[model samples]
Target: MIKPTEKPTVTLVGMDGDMLGTLRCVEKALSLAGADSEYLLKYQNEIIKDDLYKDYNRLLDVTRKYVNVRRLSREKDEEEREKARQQRRGERAGEDYKESGFES
Candidate 1:
């Protein structure tokens, strides 16, 4: 049996379309509201506000979604690995049985 730690690590980066749309709306609102701001300001505001600055509920929801996605992906990877391992075991067992003159 392969240890969990022996499995290759999977990394995922997800961006919610709704979250992106909300950001675009925010940017458009800011742009229409007053003088143009620096690109860095927009980027900083988006990151800080999403992760740290504001809307605790929204942050939790996004975090939950991200975590769920990663969890599902990892589960799928493990399932595939298990299936492959089982297939190899079956093949080896079949070869052993044949070598023992157990043909039917």
Candidate 2:
């Protein structure tokens, strides 16, 4: 049996079409966005308002909301599953159950 302190995480994603995979961690993704903005500095004609960081910030804001919602939905699902399992096991609050003896 194996036990872990934290639940498993999906780290890698498939790359298809215009998508080259993306980071699951928002902070790290934002860091990469900052790097993108820094790279844009090489373009002398680029304006500060056109910086990609701001765009990334906006997108990440929505991403953060989406991530939170998904996490919450997953947590609720896990809780419901656990409750169902407990019910199936005849384990309920202040209740007692005995298994039927029908040995073959």
Candidate 3:
């Protein structure tokens, strides 16, 4: 079986609808916003103090304009692999039949 070390990544877009970095960074940033009233309140204060929240709003804006994508599964690749495996099996069976002087 063929396996990939990492999942496929999607790209993020900027305010100008230009390509940004990988979605991994975006996910990391969102995860850093830990939950809790104090943390949330502190975040609010920081947002108000330096307009940090605007970046999230910018992200939302981009999301509204375009679809966000993610890797659902590696099943499609696995299916292709199964097809290749079946082809190899068929070839081997055909070779075996030829060697045995039998119609298969």
The TM-score between candidate 3 and the true structure equals 0.30
**What does candidate 1 score on TM?**
0.32
Scored against the true structure, residue 99 in model 1 reaches a CA lDDT of: 96
Candidate 3 Cα errors over 4 Å, as ranges: 1-73
lDDT ranking of the models? 1, 3, 2
Candidate 3: Cα lDDT at 35? 29
> What shift in Å separates residue 32 of candidate 1 from its native position after superposition?
51
In model 2, which runs have C-alpha deviations exceeding 4 angstroms? Answer: 1-72, 91-104
* 1-104: candidate 1 lDDT, tens digit per residue: 11122212222323233455444444444444342557426444545765733563464344333222222255676787789899999999999999999798
Q: Evaluated with lDDT, which candidate comes out highest?
A: 1
Worst 10 residues of 2 by lDDT: 12-21
Would you list the clashing residue pairs of candidate 1? none
Candidate 2, 37-91: lDDT as tens digits: 3432322123234442445444434444323312224556667678889887765
Candidate 3 lDDT, tens digit per residue, 1-104?
A: 22222322333333222223422343333334332345334433443565434465554344332223442235655676688899999999989989998764
Q: What is the C-alpha lDDT of each candidate?
A: 0.47, 0.36, 0.44
Better of 2 and 3 by lDDT: 3
